[model samples]
Target: MKTDKPRVAIQGIRASFHEEAAFRYFGENIETIECNSFKQTFEALKNKEADYVVMAIENSIAGSILPNYSLMMGYSYPVVGEVYVPIQLHLMALPGVRFDDVKYVTSHPIAIRQCIDFFDEYPHLKIVESNDTAACAKRIRDEQLTDTVAIANTLAAQLYGLDVLERRIESNKLNFTRFLILTTHENNKKKGPANKASLCFQVNNEVGALAKVLNVFCHENVNMSKIQSMPVLGKRNEYNFYVDIEWEEAKQFDNSIRQILKYTHNFNILGEYQQYIEDDSPKPQTKPDNTKRYITVKKIE
Candidate 1:
C-alpha cells in the first residue's frame, strides 16, 4: 500500500521533467522518488513502493521511444495517462565560463544525439554519458568542475545553480517529450476523455497481412496515429507491431477487436490514453477536437 504521501517514482532527480510530470499529475502534496532506470520504475510499482511511474515514451526529434515500448510490454503495466512536456535544451556550466571553454560534455545519450549539431562543431571535446540530462547538471554543480559542461534545461540549471552557457542547444527547437504515466490497472476508465489508444499485434507471414490490419481501422473509420515494427525477442521468423490509434473504438467494444483479430494471431489493447504534450501546441479546449494533425515521424536518415 502507498503511504499517505503518495509516492511517485520517476527516472531521475527532482528537477528532471519526469519528476516534473509526476508533480504535475500527482500534485505538490505527493512525494517523489527517483529510480535509476525505466525498468526500476516498474519494479517499484510492482513492489508497491510507488503509486505511479512517469517516464518519457517519445520525443519530437528522436521519434518513437522504441526502448520503452519493450518495457511497457515486459512490465505488463497499464499505460494509465500521458503527460506531454515541451523539452527545452540548454547548455550549462560553472560560473563565468563561456561556451568556447567547454572542454567536455556530459548528458543523456538521446540528449547528446539531439544536440549533435552543437557538439559536432566542438569535436575536440569529450562527451560523457549520464543517466538523465538533469542529473548531468547536478553532477557539474556537485563536482564543481569548471571545465566540464552539461546539456540540460533551464529548470536543471536553476535547481543546480549552474550557468546557462548556451540556451536551446537542441538541433531543433520543435523538440518535445511524451511521457506515459503507468499503473497496474488495465482499464482506461478515467474522469475525462481519452483521445488516443495504443495497440500491439503480430501477424503471420502472408501476402496481405498488414493490409488486413490496416483495413480493420480503415473500415471502422478509426484513424491510426503511429505504427512501428520490432523484431520478436527469441523468434527469428516473427515480428511484432506496436501501434497507436484514435480512441473512438473503445465505445464499439467487440466490434473493434473482432475486426482486428481476423488477420493477427494475437493483439493487445495497450490503453486509451491522451497526448498531453506537443511542441508549440495549445491544449485542446473542447471535446472531439480532432482537427490537429498527427505528428508525422519522418524516416530517420
Candidate 2:
C-alpha cells in the first residue's frame, strides 16, 4: 500500500499559496492533502496521514503569522527545511468579463490588504473577505460569476480558466512568504547537515535576563537571524522567546546552545535545518509583453 511519492499536507485548498509552496518544496510528483487550517495541517502530520507539512511562518509585507508560531510550540513538529515564495497577486474573472464588469473583489484578508493600493482606484468595487485566495477564484469559476473578481496567483487563474483582469496588483512587488518544511522527529534525525536552527525558551522576568542569553550566542559566533517574544498565556509578565540562528560550524552552535540552556528555563530546540537563500538572477519572462516576471518556485526534492 506504500508509495514512493511523499504526501504533503498544506493549510489551504488546491492552488492556494500553501499548495504552491508544498509543490515547490516536495516536487510536483508528491500528493497534496489539503487542510482547512494550519492547526489541521499539523494534525495531519501528527496523526501519520501526511509525510510532511508545509506551513507559512512569515510574509514580507504582512509580518509574521503569530498564530502559526504558537501552533508550532504546541505541536512540536520538527522543521527539516524552508522555502521562500514570491507573492504575486493577480485580479482574475470569467473570460469575457472586463475591468468595469467587476462589481466585487474577493480574496484572503492578507491578500486583500496587500492589493489595497490597486483597489483604491476603483471605489465602486466592493472588497469582500474570503477564507482563501484560491477558494475565491474557484468560487467565481464554479458559480459562473461574471461580475466577481478574485485576487490570487497566476496558478489559480490558469487552473480555473479565468482570464487575468489585472496583473501584479499587490502594493509591493517584492512581497514574499517564507514556509517551513516540517516532519516527524524520527524523520528529522535522518536529514542531512543543517546550518540553521529554530529554538524556543523562557527566561526569568528580570532586567537584562534576555540580553544575557543573546550575548551567549554572540560569544559563540552564532548569527541570530530572528527573535520573537510571545506572552505566556495565564502567566503574568512571562514570555516565550522563539529564535532562529545560523552557524558555519556545528561545534559553535552546540556550545552556544549549552551556554544558553544555563540561563533559560524550559528551553526547546524546535529544529535544525538547511537555510534557504533566494537566487538573484534575471528570470525569463512568461508573457510576450514582459509585463510580469515568473515567480520562481524552487525545488528542494
Candidate 3:
C-alpha cells in the first residue's frame, strides 16, 4: 500500500533504536531521514529537510543524555510527543558463528555499558566502541567477520543477515529509553492537547530562591516529574534548572507557569506535549527461530 508519509529525522541508521522509536510514534509507514548525530537530526528539521525529529532524551540504565538537553535549549525545537523504546541488547555475528568463535565485541559506548555484566562473563573477548549499534552489525555482515560480534537490537541482526548469538544481553532487563518528538516552531503552533510541559529557568543567586519556585507549582497542584540542574557557562554560582511537570487541570498548569515566571530568570518553555506513559507489567519474551529470515520484536509492555 502506497501512501504519503511524514519524513522523520532520526539520530542513527535505519535499523537503529532511534528508528524503532520513530516507527512506534509515527507508525511504520513514516519515512526516515538518517542523521549521523543528534545535532544533525535537529539540523534536518531546522533546514526544512525533515518534517519531524525523533531524538533520545534519556535511558533508564544510563541516565540522561545531558548534551541533548543543551541542544533542545539551543535549537528551541518544540517537543510534540514522546515515546519509550526498550533497550534490548543482543549479541549478533555472521551466520553459523558460535559464541566461542567470537573474539571481539563492538557497539555504541552506551550499549556496551548496559551489557557490561554480560560481557564480564567472557573475559577473553576484546571490547570495542563504535559510532552506532546497527552500523556495527552491518560492518560484520558486509565484511563477513567471523570473529567479530555486534551488540545491537534484533532488527539489526535481521537487517544485516546476522545471527543472534545471545539475546537480551543488557545488564538491566528493564532498560528503556525515552525519546522526544520534535518539530519546528511553525509546525508546533497548533500542537495537540498537552498534559505535560518542560520548562527551563534560572533562579536568583540567593537562598530559598529555588524553593520559592517549587512552592508555586505545589500551590497550583502541579506534579513535578523531573528536575535537573545544569551549570551556566561563563557564570559563577548560577545554574539552569530543567523541570518536567504534569497536570490534570490545564488552568493549574497555566497558573503555575505564570507564577513561576516571576520567581526565575531567563525562563523558557522548552515544550508542552502529551507525556508518554509506560506499561505496568513486563511482556512475555519470545525467542526467535534461526530459520526465520526477518525477526520482529514485540514492544515491551
Top candidate, metric lDDT: 2
Error of 3 at 10 (Å): 1.0
Clash-forming residue pairs, model 1: 84-277
TM-score of each: 0.83, 0.91, 0.90
- Give the per-residue lDDT digits (tens) of candidate 2, residues 210-243: 9999999999999999998999999999999999
Ranking by lDDT: 2, 3, 1
Best by TM-score: 2
**Per-residue alpha-carbon lDDT of candidate 1 for residues 1-301, written as tens digits (9 for 90 to 100):** 3447666778877578886676556555666667777777777778777767787888888788778889888887877687777777888898887777778999999889989998888889999988888889888888888889998876677778888878888888877777888877832346466767788899987788888888877777777878899989899879889887774546553466687897887688887676554346353322212232112122222
Q: Report how far off residue 113 is in candidate 1 (Å).
A: 2.1
Between candidates 1 and 2, the one scoring higher on TM-score is 2
lDDT of 1: 0.76
Error of 3 at 11 (Å): 1.0
| Candidate 1 vs candidate 3, TM-score winner | 3
Candidate 2: clashing residue pairs, number: 0
Which segments of candidate 3 are over 4 A away from where they belong?
1-3, 189-191, 279-301
lDDT of 3: 0.85
Clashes of each: 1, 0, 0
